[model samples]
Target: MTSGYLWLKAIHLVFVASWFAALFYLPRIFVNLATVPADSHAERERLLLMGRKLYRFGNLLMLIGLALGLWLWLGWGAGRFAGTGWLHAKLLLVVGAIGYQHVCRAHLRRFERLENTRTHRWFRVFNEVTVLLFAAIVILAVVKPF
Candidate 1:
């Protein structure tokens, strides 16, 4: 790989890591929000504020990371990997990660409206989904096992 490709990959990896950090923490916030006493208005409001900010930041990171990844693929000749099954699987996992973020947004909106019915345990499980997705994505990217 060229030096330029290596630099782009490094930057993309940084943003992707930041993005995944948000994904990993946002649901933990949800878990806390779910457990907040119904009468603790201040606590709920604080958690909601944090969630909103994190979601917005995460969205920005995801966009930058994805754009950089696309450039690396299309502009830096990584597109040659397009013929491989591993690339296809990796792309599918990327889509799933994006979908998972949206689902987190939906849950956040519900919490904002005070309509969330899910338990803390549910959010705990939801948080693990991102971890699983991250592990699979990394394995596919590195191992490229078909």
Candidate 2:
């Protein structure tokens, strides 16, 4: 592969890594934020703050990766997103990830009610989505569905 390909892949990997790491932690933080006891509202606050940071940073990485991927797919090649099936798969996974991020943001807003009603199981479901998302992203990038 050419140096440009190598650089593109490198940036994509970095962005993927950052996205997944944040994806993993953000949900856990959400789980914690949701389950925190009424008496421990302070802890809930902290978790919410941390989750916010994670979600924000994760989105930043995801966006940057999207830009790099688009550049690599279009400008580097014949045209953007022309014949890259693998890149298409990766793009789909990113869309899923972005959807999950939006869900997290919505839930974060609900936390303002201080209801603390969501259970660990609820978070587990969110966790499942991220896990699947991360797996799909990795597979698409590495396997390059071609």
Q: Name the top lDDT candidate.
A: 1
Query: Which candidate wins on TM-score?
Result: 1
* TM-scores for all predictions: 0.98, 0.85
Clashes of each: 0, 1
Q: Output the TM-score of candidate 1.
A: 0.98
RMSD of 1: 0.6
What's the C-alpha lDDT at position 76 in model 2? 76
RMSD (CA, angstroms), candidate 2 = 2.2
Q: 2-87 in candidate 1: lDDT tens per residue? A: 89889999999899989999999999999999999989999999999999999999999999999999999989999999999999
lDDT of 2: 0.78
Candidate 1 global lDDT = 0.95
Error of 2 at 13 (Å): 1.1
- After superposition, the stretches of candidate 2 with alpha carbons farther than 4 Å from their true spots are 78-81, 84-86, 115-117
Q: Estimate, for each residue in 47-74, the C-alpha lDDT of model 2 and write its tens digit.
A: 8888778778988987887788777767
